[model samples]
Target: MLPKPIPPQPGQESVWDYPRPPRLERTAKRLRVVFAGTTIAETTQGWRVLETSHPPVYYFPPADILPDVLVATPRTSYCEWKGMAQYHSVRVGQRIAPDAAWSYPRPTPPFAPIAGYVAFYAAAMDACYVDDELVVPQPGGFYGGWITKDIVGPFKGVPGSWGW
Candidate 1:
């Protein structure tokens, strides 16, 4: 059974109200990622994917990310809604976070706007922010959702949440 969703306060959103198929929407919120004392990415032109029981996953356009920081990896994963995803390791100076980011080179039609845009795992980074609010990584390492103050959930990725 699905867990009870937290009641959202004014100006907040509840993830349980999000749709099953996931919706990809453009966002002008300043998204930033920092690792190893370097600002690896910062973008106002980003997309966010929202699905039930999950926090939003922010995607940054390729131009906003530092090119040298991403090292392409052979890893790939299939998502039922987004299509195939390619992984990348994030490297800054001597630090490396393997498979810390992912992108879709060719997404399903509805998600085409995010093609080649990258999304980083907040858990793997020193910090990630939406506007000025620091992000909390989604509960599990498997999902790349960014949990900010304005979002509420009895989110997925927690133990006993798999069947949600």
Candidate 2:
């Protein structure tokens, strides 16, 4: 059973209200990812994917990420709403986060705008910010959502949420 969703305060959004098939929306909020003392990616032209019981997963345009930071891996995964996802390892100097980012190179029609756009796992990064607010990584390693103050949830990656 799904846990009760936290009531959202004014100016906040409940993840329970998000749609199941997921919605991809372009956001003007500044998004930034930092690791190993380097700002790996930052952008205002980012996109966010919202799905039921999950915090928003922000995607950055490939052009905005620091060059040579991402190295592709052979690993891939599939999403019912999106399509095949390709994994990438994030590397900066001697620090590396393996399979810490992913992208859908050829997504479903509705998700095409995010093709080649990258999404990083907040847990693997030193910090991730949305509009200057530091984000809490969504619970569990399997999901890559970023939890900000304005987003409320009994998020899917928490223990006992697998069946949600």
Candidate 3:
């Protein structure tokens, strides 16, 4: 059963209001990711995927990420809407966050805008920021959505909300 969505207060957005098949949107907002005391990625050009019951998953362009920071892993996963996905481990200094990032190298047509763009798991990074606000990682390890003050939810990936 789907959980009732939390109503958004002024200036917030409800995840339930997002689309089912998800939509990729280009954003000019400043995006930042930090790990192991280093700012590993930062960009003003990024894409975000919004889906029903989930917060936005932001993707940064390849040019914004630091060189040699991403090491491809053998892991692969499939997204019904985005097609095959590949994983990457991010390393900075002595820290290694395994399978902490992913990309759709050859995305399905509808998601082609995000092809080769990398999305990181907020929980796996020391910090992630949308503009100046720090993000809260979406609940549950499997979903990489980043939650900021503007997004409201009884979001998916919570214990009983998986079936949503």
Candidate 4:
């Protein structure tokens, strides 16, 4: 991506060769969120997918999501850079995706921007949308940002962008 401020180091490599996401000035326009699939399995906060070698992760706002639908799980994972991430389970109809979503209650300093946040696996969702347009999940079990008309790709999980 054009605005990739730092280049990929040795092992990190990079998925950016096109352009970086638009930077914010602390007051960026809010992108509308839309949920699809059965039971509207989605995060309330608008999530941005940062394309990487790993699967696309959907970041959500704590307040934006329906509170009753989620249940805190005892599971936890630690990321040296991102800090300790907490897990939560989602219940939809007869289906229950346990620990399918995660959050950072107390993230490391650098990742504090994502504090009190949650993320979901793209594959776990039944349906999702942004505005009137529908969203298509990126393959390889990825779910970064919602696919919209404004965004262009060579996106990962779409087709040729696999292994991205």
Query: Per-model C-alpha lDDT, please?
Result: 0.96, 0.96, 0.95, 0.53
Consecutive 10-residue window with the lowest summed lDDT within model 1: 154-163
Question: How much does each candidate deviate from the true structure in C-alpha RMSD?
Answer: 0.6, 0.6, 0.7, 7.7
Q: Rank the candidates by lDDT, best first.
A: 2, 1, 3, 4
TM-scores for all candidates: the values are 0.99, 0.99, 0.98, 0.58
For candidate 3, lDDT tens digit of each residue in 1-164? 77888999999999999998998899999999999989999999999999999999999999999999999999999999999999999998788999999999999999998899999999999999999899999999999999999999988888988789
Comparison by TM-score, 2 against 4, better one? 2
- Per-residue lDDT of 61 in model 3: 97
How high is the lDDT of residue 162 in model 1?
A: 82
**lDDT tens readout by residue for model 4, 15-107:** 443323321112122433322434443333454435433222446667767756678999988866567888877776566777767888997
Write one digit per residue (lDDT tens) for candidate 1, span 1-164.
Answer: 76888999999999998998999999999999999999999999999999999999999999999989999999999999999999999999899999999999999999999999999999999999999799999997899999998999988999888888
Q: Where is model 4 more than 4 Å wrong at Cα?
A: 1-15, 18-57, 142-164
Candidate 2 residue spans exceeding 4 A from truth: none
